[model samples]
Target: MATIATVTVPRRTPRRVYLERATYLGAAIGLAILPNADLTPATLGAHAAIAGAAGLGLARAWRKAQNLDASSLKTSMRALPFLSAAAVDGAALYLPGAGWDALIAGGWGVSMALLAPLSRSGRPLRQAVEVLEAIEEPEPEGEPEGGPEDDADEFTRTIRAMWERAALPGDTRLYKVIRHSPDGLDFTALVKAPDGKPVPELKKRDVAAAFGVHAEAVTIIESTGGPGWAEIAVTPDAWEAERDKPQTDADWWAHNIGREQGAAPGSTRTGKAERPGVVHHFAKMDDPSEPVRINMRKLCTAFGADTDEMRVFVTDRGNEFLVSVFDQPPLADTVHATRELITPNREGFFRAGTAFDGRPVNGRLYLPGGAAHALLLGASGSGKTQLVIVYMAADSLDGATVWGAAATEDAKLRLAGAHVDRLGFGTLYMVRLLRTAVALMDIRGRMGQKVGHDWIPGAPDNAYGRLSLYLDEFNAATKCPRYGQEITQLGERISVQGRKYGIGIKVSGQDGKVDDGQTSTMRNQLRLNGRQITLNVGDVSAVRRAFNGLISAEDMPEPLPQEYGGSTLTLQQIADGAEDPEDAQGIGGIGWVVRGGKPVLMRTLYVDLGGDDREQVLADLFPDTIGRLTDEETTGLGPLLDDWYAPDPDAEEGAGESSTGRRRRGGGTKKAAARDRVKTFLDMMPGADLDLVLNAVAEDGLTEADITAAYNELTSE
Candidate 1:
């Protein structure tokens, strides 16, 4: 069976309606004023006729706008009173006497002005008003969509409109499913694009773009009812995401730390008094992209929780803030313990520690193409030297070629081992040592270029066997007179080229070392692919310079005690007493290790230097120190007799007599070359243990007599 569709035609507005709409006010006012003003019958009649005709013509013109006649149900109500008043006044204008007619026209004029805004089709005008209203107000337009009607019915109407819009191929219908108001529509939206298709439930970003608010402020939900339908909500998340971002000190306290508003003045609703929260910013804070355990302190920084008494507590789980700033932390301190440092070096790992909650805190500076150099820094008693010793022990024990230079034979200067192939001391000698290193670096660079590859990441047993220059108190070496600048410049060159040549420079120093451009250049080169430690500095400026000015000193931990020097303290140790009056929040650590251009808190290892471990370590690396050489084996150890002197020119080749003196028993008159060897060896070591030197001389293949003679001659000098 075929169905017939009914066609409806739009109704045209009457000409009078358009005429009245345009000329009603003028005509009414003129009629009212005409009665009060002096005028002849011809003028008054002509004016009345003119006004009426003009009103009719205007109404007739507006009548043609039939498409604009769709009035809203509510807007139609507003149009009613005006239309009625117009009718009443029109009747009064005809029925009343002169003065009363004036009153009626004036009344009509007032009604016309009020009705002007509603003159267009009431629904279009209502929608247009709603759009304007939504923009003009802070809240959305969902507020005024309802009137005195059953909410369920209103909701049904709303959902039905949504479905209709969503189902439509080309039309727009913005109706709320659930307006935030208790009696507003339900959570519903029938979103459709201009392509005559329903827009799918969008992601947060899309929804935010659609609604013109922040992505964080809008929550999107894909309703289960149908396709291309979703719900978007407005929330305060955008504002909350920016917590801990204070524009000023007072702003930080007022907005981030505590309540911005207190109970109304003297109101009965008064509660707790206001207080400032102690602020704690996390060092080495994790990135938001990485998963982190939720905590009060992290949350406080995340979505501002404010109070002056905020106490921060750090635990294995993460950092947390408490309501009481003076309370103990939720976690315990990590105590140091000793263990034999027996671990062999592995790929990407050169050092490991048990300082971080008993877990192995591995230190690695091996990049894809180079071995890591290192810089150790700390104040006195802050453990910088100890750390250096630990590192050297590890490297030496692993068979790395260890070379050391020091200004004095201090305790930290004692790193002698089998792997310590050579040592240099004093300003001039250290400068010479650095100059030699610069030459070696040049040689290695040339070799790499010739071989079509820069030598790097080579094993200890590789061609180079991994050489490391451990410079103790690098600042002292850089201050050598007449050679300081040369040393620094050469050091910078080595620093730049060393990493690519199976070589690394481990430099240790206190503050004030980087006082020159050469030092600064060397520091920058070391910063890349170099392991680093920076202990506590007494002043803010020091920290800023040490940390490269990326952090604020106010956010750093307090300075160390006066008695302490060169030894690092853990966060727990510093916190133990820094804020005794307020135990709420604290972080204490002696220094930080630089990683990826940021400082990570130092996790120092507990090295076992006890009898057995120390002996074993020494024995493994220095078996020569385990026993003494007999004196009979060192009797004749001195300048070799054959090399003691040059030939006497005046004497014949075989003659014992010469121009200066008789030829030596083994050869010509004596020379300083043989004695110089012994002198250089003694100077390089300085105050060497007698037995150890005897063993060294024995290892050098010197006979007992020669060894003893060399030692006696060198000591006497």
Candidate 2:
């Protein structure tokens, strides 16, 4: 029979063999004392042969394992050599005279058996086997098309999601989302009606309550579970009717006294409290559904602003009041809100609402009561005059009257044509203060072309409502002693008391610097109370002080980098700590802010009345320098030219005409060259007109050289 040998495999390397050697060495003495133990030389020789062969075989197997993968079947096959060596060493214990040898061989066999299994050579194979045994399988499917909701429904869901995401404040609910043409999406929200009245929800009565009455009906329109804002529209016809009716100061007092007596039931109306300029009796417009109510004081305050100067007449329409004055003419757009600033360097600087072209215009602060006096300071060509013209024309359109004296003959003429009722205060006609007062009284008659007697002194009855006593070139006004005194007195009155009487003052200069005594008085009045509209202040101390050091050259608007223009910080802002952005809303020449019990900004529409307005006014004031002319076209080599150049008799009659006509260049010249010269002269004007041409020139891609060549060629004889 083939020998079926029990092979003991070594689990480890020589380190294992060394441990076995130590154990055998220790047992040698013990085994020697045994009766069956043979310590013969031949027995030792056999043990040595087995040990050597075992060691050599194990090394060979290890080398073979290196060539084959330690984790492969080749490594396992190669292990037989080491296992056979360990078995031979173990079998040595049964040989004759092998007592000591048996001990050594047995020790080596046990060590190799234990260590062989612990070796790292088989680790990779074990890991691979374990990995192959672990995995998973798949399961069946669920519904594919998902419960059938159309795309519109899905879109609606999205809108709802967006609405939820907005997460507005607690006391506020998003109202109507008006898709306005100019302003894009506008959120119309109602805040508890501005009166101290409680408004729990949007109702017809709540709208009426804002106007101090009740609405006739209530309506509710819900969205189709879609995402859109909410809106409440209400008409308070009855409340408006009561609010619009006119009432005198006495009538107001009587109404309040009746209320006090009625409140106490048995109380007598003996000594009643003083009332405001106007009063009213209001109740919910006889509508059960309208949620209208009132806070009496709020009604009084809102209407009281315009009631002092005229009778407040209520229109039959909803919440509309017609202010009664000289003749009850229609109100202009400015009467409600100021006109836009025409030649602003900064875009969107003063927009209160978006324009028709979708440009933002809202957030502009309107002057409280629309009655503010402005002090402008700028150099001659700094666009000050143009800005002033826009401002005044805008005011007139808004129902405010303007009366001003120009420092330059050109400006005076321009202003007169724009507002024909302007009183000429040029050098030829230096109207005295008393004369000005008379002119103020005669403004209506002059405008109507009806003759009237001059104003009589000490006649309060003839004094007009409120007048803007504009003294252009304020420095010049101060030079005249009498004018300065009158200005001081007038400023004191207007600064302190004008608002109550509806009078305002506007003082300007080509530059706002003044060293004369009038500076102190004027500055004091302005500081106390007045609006300061500065443009291109140019290191002028007085202008700097007026603006409280906020104005600078670099602050000029973007389009016109080199051009100069900007608004000054408002007075209220300066008074109540000018550091905060809110207070300094008007720091840029764009919008207004309301702060410290005043209209922080007056929504001013800069109305560029066109350069023609300026040119016309200048013609009237300085006909001499500006020259008189009639357009003439003669069929000649060139367009028939008539030179009206002559010495301005007003300046110095014998001064003689300039090299050309009084106008910059004499009339006839090459079409292109003459066009260039005229354009150059016009481009040199200040403000809007000049800016327009400059913009055009840039767009046309014309260079200075091109213009110069054109001028030289055209003017050449």
Candidate 3:
């Protein structure tokens, strides 16, 4: 056996320890001297002030110590010396005698010295050299076997290993395990990045790979707890099950009412037990006053469903948003327009289609006391033309005067059977139609002003009623070199000033790009105060432009599939030389409608524009006859119509004739006619302001540009 030795190590006093001891000694001396001091007013005041300062210092020290630790007894013990000194000083101010001063100073000195042992600031350090010398060296042992891996839980260990394997920036550590089930796990975590480095973006695919699960099994969103935190959930099989499970009316009802309804216990088929529905398992009540809320986003993630598959709709009462889950997107199915659907409701809102959440998508052409313009943007095969047809039919049925302008011959043929008060084709005809619309808008405005109110849609005395201008393939006319500038100016004016007069403009185009023949002024005026709908566009940027950046690329509707729900021709069929199947052209009019300055994914009602029944459908959809403009409403429109039909001066004698094959008597031009018309109007309305004169001549179907030209020509003469 080897002998063991022990050695004593002396304590070394720290500088702070010495200073503390000196402070106590100084207090003791001050107490001793204070009692013998001269008994004068100044001296007494000085003594009391000094005592007060000391007492304040002690109180501050006690407060600081209390804040530093929850152990009140330990704090009091640490502050015992200062407290005692303060008490003695305070007593010296009232008991001014040498004997009392001496007694207090001696007692203070003894108490402080006795408590000195409690101070650990000068604790003794082990004498390393002496200890080493006293102990016998043990035989060298083999390298100690490494202890079992760190005591962290299995989940934590797995997370650490996965983090390292994924090559993710920063160290990911489990913060808390929110839930653990046989199907999945939910948890929050903290990411510790290296100094001066930002938290790395954790891609879902990478994280899933690290966890040996599919990408849809994982969800990561910013934690509301704080920055540098993330909420993660992993549901491996739940998503697959959710996708495969067929949704039923019961499920819809359960989600709508935030409760689970089922057959009651111990009840026969004939008679079932009556009981109140129980709260939904997934519903959370964050506040008693609020409706039961469900985490729709989280549920969607867990089910591996898209936004369209799991949606929320406001209930009929509008008190809560009810969740609706579907095996397939409801909008994927077509919703045909019906008489009731196209007809305006009591509030004058037409049912466009069903929202993703199974709620009716309603749209109105008029605002509270004014009309509203609309802009529809979509690419080819996006069903935009069909949607416009439906809307036009609705407007006609609603008793509005529908003016149609088609830039293409095909568009003209499509609207030929509809109840269009005035249907024009080609850029020339389109420009003429626009000029006429502007004149009518001005006339309506003046009429409203005369009546001392804005135009009302169905007022008994209202003569003009509602007027809607529909422009199909608007880009074609807006891009025409000869008429694009004038068309753009006229469209802008109508978009800005036509609403109050019950005149609205609806323009359909391939995209909303200003550079694509649509001037910035025209796009802004239309989009700023008008309703916008965007179907499957050519690109993400087009969607952004359509909604003025309200919808981002990620939020855009999924591209319209080539073959919607229909099956495509199989490879085997193709190899066998089978004919291609005629599938649905687009995603049943899938698109987005901007509501309340936010883009909401929706689908417009589908109207069958193809097949043999197309003609009958058009006839039934639109009125056979529209209310014609009365004689008074057509005032001054003759010259504009004549100018529109005026033959080209450059054409041969026979070819330079109007559409009705009539020749101008004096070989006069529309500009010359406008000059005369304006001269006559100004003469009749003598001393009238420019506005009054313009209003008086607006019924003549003359645009502001035409009037301005006539004015310039007359003034120059």
Per TM-score, the best of the predicted structures is 3
**What's the C-alpha lDDT at position 48 in model 3?**
69
Look at candidate 1 and tell me the lDDT of residue 217: 54
Q: Give TM-scores for every candidate, taking all chains together and pairing residue i with residue i.
A: 0.44, 0.27, 0.52
| lDDT tens per residue, model 2, 293-379 | 222233324344222212222211122111222211111123112333321222112332222112333321123342345566555
- Could you give me the TM-score of model 2 versus the true structure? 0.27
lDDT of 3 at 27: 65
lDDT of 1 by residue, 1-717 (tens): 111122232343433345446665775665565544556887667556655654554454455444455433444444444454445444654564776776677776666654543343333434564477445433322353432121334434544443443343334344444544444322334343332245544566544443334554556565443343334564433344455354653334334333213211111111122334323332211232322232344333533332222223222212221222223221123333222443344564644443222245454545567767777766555556556656665555545566677665655345343335566566555655664454445445545565566655643333344567777777776665444554676677678777777677878776634685237767876666576667655565566666663333433433433322122345797888554333232222346654333344444653334445654544453323222112321222222111212332223334332343333434532333234334444554465544434433232234556656777887987
Model number with the top lDDT: 3
Q: Residue 89 in candidate 2 has what lDDT?
A: 49
Candidate 2: C-alpha lDDT: 0.37
Q: How would the candidate models be sorted by TM-score, starting from the highest? A: 3, 1, 2
* Alpha-carbon shift of residue 501 in model 3 (angstroms): 1.8
Off by over 4 Å in 3: 1-324, 411-413, 416-418, 519-529, 551-585, 642-717
User: Better model by lDDT, 1 or 2?
Assistant: 1
